[model samples]
Target: MQKESVIKVEHITKTFGLTKALTDVSLEIGYGEIRGLIGENGSGKSTLASMIVGTGHPDSGEMWYRGEKHNPKNMLESKEKKINILIQENGTINGLTVAENMFLGKESTFSKSGNVNKRRLIEEGSKALARIGAGHINAADRIEKLSFEDRKLVEVAVAMYNEPEVLFVDETTTALSQKGRELIYKLMDEMREAGKTIVFISHDMAELERMCDSISVLRDGHFVGTLQKEEITQDTLKRMMIGRELTGDYYRGDYEMSYQEEVVLEVDNVTWGETVQDISFQLHKGEILGLGGLTECGMHELCKIIFGAIKPDSGSVHLTDGTKITSPSSAIKSKIAYMPKDRDLESLFLATSIKDNIVMASMDKIKKGFFIPPRAEKELADEHAGKLEVKMQNTSQYVRELSGGNKQKVVVAKWMANGSEILLMDCPTRGIDIGVKAAIYRLMEQLKKEGKSIIMVSEEMPELLGMSDRIIVMKDGKQTGEFERSEVLSEHDLIHAML
Candidate 1:
């Protein structure tokens, strides 16, 4: 059977100054199909989507929507033709209510003689939310009142309300819970039934296999190939996406390094509002502990608690070396480092130079008394950047120009340069490529060898299993189970414990 093409790209090439974001990439998505776009960060997946939505323009070639040639000058023009994009970044206004955000520009429709009709606006927004199976959200509630997952749902609601012919979801599921993910999946099915085409981008390969009718691989601004469902496997997809066969374990390799058996850090019956309840854990010197759980299972809150990002209402954390710390400032003073899950928002200074970002964590190292030595700072930055294998033209280049993987490496380099002993990493490998993931794992091993204790929080089951000497599973703010690396636990067991 011949498939109906909804959108077609022919020899599309987009260049940003000297960098080739896309190189003569050609692809097609059929009507009602969910197409997966897989690639490493900076591989041009986002660039292609931006070009398709008219936020970006190709240097050469053309794109077609339905049967008509499309050369959308801007996002408004593309929206006029029923093409919408939901970017990875949140685009909603924080001050607005959920209803107002959902309707946004369309709120003018509720105006009666130029006065805003609040009642009608809320009513319409409520109905729109119901249509997308998100009726639980209060239309009048402020956007800031909702959690990150709920905010993401509102963004999806806005896109669905627009009723576009083609929708692009770029790495949105990582923020969502399993239930929320299911809700989005159901909406995708409903949209497909209504003849909408979807371009889905995610780091989770299992999800892509389940949702996508076909998958396209991109690497270094070039289109590698597209594969049908039957023609693709996760390993095959990884190989195609990165242009190499991934070897070794995805996590920590076998090592004989042993900790002092003395607990270096301990959390005693910690409570963080309702999210984390009576949680207790211990970290020994030179030990890597893995935290695994479902989205709402308190693992994230636990990490934040340990990192001093959030203060626990009850209980106390103490360093075994006889130092007491109460805040993130104290934690940093104690040589503890936290690599946040949301790297863009929490860890990185995006507009700053890579050199500046690398040195941001440890300014005292390059300081002589109260004065900062610029020469020493530059030398230290260069050394760490080279050690991390950060692929940048120059250390002075803005961090925003680096790929997601390289940006993450800079985060690691920052803490490593500071000589941090206890590292708190929450989803460190999220959205990074296999090559970079391998590099990070190798770094973890090296850190262990240097007597740095790591507390890794990851959603990927394999990562938790492969990297940690011991794994702890949490559910509903409580520790449900624990496994030693020698125990050989399965993903099912971990998922069960998490759920």
Candidate 2:
């Protein structure tokens, strides 16, 4: 006999302006199961999850939870009914303390008359963090002071604190390192053991195959199919997602360490407030130099220093021509571009149009006598958007409407439009689908062929091994090892250095 579903939806359809996000999509999530939701970007995976968690609603559909008609008016209502979600982006508000963010909506739980007991709030928040194996985070600290990984853990603590019957983890793992990923995976396993349901949305195929009981595929706002546990494979899921076979390897095929020896950019003795320590490296003219480390390690900070987003306390970043990059403007003037790990917060102007963002970086280049022509801006945006294969109505569309993968494309598009010679990409492919990953990899190869240097900072070991001509590893704000690309190199070697 088939198992009873904990939640069910029927004939769900949602539309956002001219974009049809979902159409006649229906699925049942079973109790005590981890259901992997896989799809390419803009494939309605997040849309469906949002609807279920009450962050969004369908124009036409019916949903039932525990055999009752269920339609939550907002996220708070869903949380009241033991349903919660950890979103793809950082969910914690900036300017709030860790305890304040943890108990944001449920202030009455610690309210006395009209005043909130801050002490009790911190006490409970610390316990919540401990429950998720994150006791190292201080509840009294400001949320903004924490690292991106720690803020993610705070979100996880909030989501799991209520002991929800249903939890939607929307690409949350993409922001995490191996330790954080394991914490979440262990929590999911415990939830399964307790007969709860977890709707996991992710672009990582290997993670889905390992953690899910069954996998569901969505394609262009439609439910393609679901694979039973025995039927799930990377190849099968990829075919279902893009509706075609992935013809070549997902990463770069060459193993030979090939790049021009001309030193284009150099970082020497860079240190930043204990997060980065005495890191030095030379980026070559046609090289893909990989920086691998744990999320808390200094590689991400090093990328920022290289791009002049963060000034090192005791070191310098300069070019072959002796141009010292002191700030972002100087970096841009030196033909350097940076793609930060936190795309929505750090990299993009979310409230603006795609054309504006693409042309923003190239304003000096596209300007005509102190005034950029509208036609010139449109032409430049359209050219790079087309080159990047950005799926959109037009360049005039707001960037907030684009999917995660496409938003990343816009970040790349802006730099490409700027004619940057040096690229600093920190976690470039985080939370992106395989199709888009392949596209970005191809772009990297093309850039390398054209003698544009790249510094790739990533938490994924496989990506570092696959793309780097030279790999540098870091642990606890210090460089531990470096390796040249060879056919014999493996993830094991990188992991050794990272630890």
Candidate 3:
């Protein structure tokens, strides 16, 4: 028996300025189904999800939910209809208490005489957290106090708090660790059992295969095809995503990478409050040094120390020529680049144009008497954006409008424009699809060939083994094991070190 269609989108079209994000896309999501949506960056998966979740509206066409017109006026209206979204980024505001963050926009029940009952809000928030298997988080604690991974859990809790009939999970697992991801998967399964619909968007193909019943492919905002569980395969999906045969080399070619004798950057006895304890590492010229660790193992903190984004308590980071990196400005001036994990919040100015973002690091170089030449800035930005193959209508498009993968390309473009000698990349491929991931891997290899040093901090072990000249494994904020890349190095060995 065919399951009933719970939500239906008919010939929906959406445009961002001149960029056609979606065109004549049509689909129907069945009740109790986990529908997987896959595409490269800028492929319209998130755009479609956002439209359905009432974050935005399509420029043309109509959608229906439960056989009724479903043009939601606002997020609150969508939730009232039992439709909810878990957005890709951390949506909660900082400085607010966890309870306040969770119950934002819906305080009517907790309100009395124009006053919010703070205790009742906290109690309900605590229950929600516990229900989502995130009881570790304190409802009364400030949202900013939670770690990035924990905050993601809170986002999930908020989305599920209303017991939504149709849930949209948008590239969320990429931000979570194994346990957190497992908890979400468990919830999805339970929701399916309860006859709820899930519109799942993910770059993790493996997870999608395991969790989704029907898989849909979108390429450049057009609905290509939808495959059932038995019909879905990685190669088939990849082909649909790029509209071509994908070359096998997603990482650097299998070769023995030789490191230069010269150390480009040195983190000598760097120490930070509990996060990093007496960490020391050398980023050699032309070497791709990999930092592998579990979530919150302090690799992120160490990257910030190297970039001079955070001050180390007792040690110094320096170029081999003896220039100190005591601040981000000094590091950038010294031809050092840092790509943060949080691309949207940390790496990008969302409201600004792509050209502006690309030219940000090269402001001094493009300046004409303390002012930048508009033409030169645009030309330089265009060159880098083209090199990265960022899919957009124009360089003037706001970065906030681009997809997850394209935004990452912009981040890389910024550093490339600066022509940095040493690059600090943390989770460079996080929340991105295979095509963009391949491009970044190729770029990293090319940079190494150009004699530039790269310090790659990642939780993805395959990427570490695939691209690194030497891998440093961390556990509990300390280096556990170091391995020079070799075919004989087992993943089990790396996992042991991370644990």
Q: Top TM-score: which candidate number?
A: 3
Candidate 2 lDDT (Cα, 0 to 1): 0.92
Once superposed on the true structure, which residue ranges of model 2 sit more than 4 Å away at CA?
1-3
Candidate 3: C-alpha lDDT: 0.90
Residues 1-499 of candidate 1: C-alpha lDDT, one tens digit per residue: 1248888899999876677889989988899888999898889988898898988889899888887888999988998889998766567788999888988877679898899899888888888888888889998999889877788888888888888999998888876778998999998888888888999988788899999989999999999999998987888998988888876466655633356686889988999888888988889877889999987889998898887888899987889766766788899989999998878778899999988998987897788999988888889899999998897777888998777788999999899889898999999898777778888988888887778899999988889888888889998888899987754567887888886
Which parts of model 1 have CA positions greater than 4 angstroms off?
A: 1-3, 255-258, 369-371
**What TM value does model 3 have?**
0.97
Mark the 10 consecutive residues where model 3 has the least summed lDDT: 248-257
Point out the higher-scoring one by TM-score: 1 or 3.
3
Decide which is better by TM-score, 2 or 3: 3
Reference-based TM-score of each model:
0.93, 0.96, 0.97
Error of 1 at 456 (Å): 1.0
In model 3, how large is the Cα lDDT of residue 397?
87
Candidate 3: clashing pairs of residues: none
For model 1, the run of ten residues with the poorest summed lDDT: 248-257
Ranking, lDDT, top scorer first: 2, 3, 1
Candidate with better lDDT, 1 vs 2: 2
lDDT tens per residue, model 2, 396-459: 9999889899999999999999999999999999999999999999999999999999999988
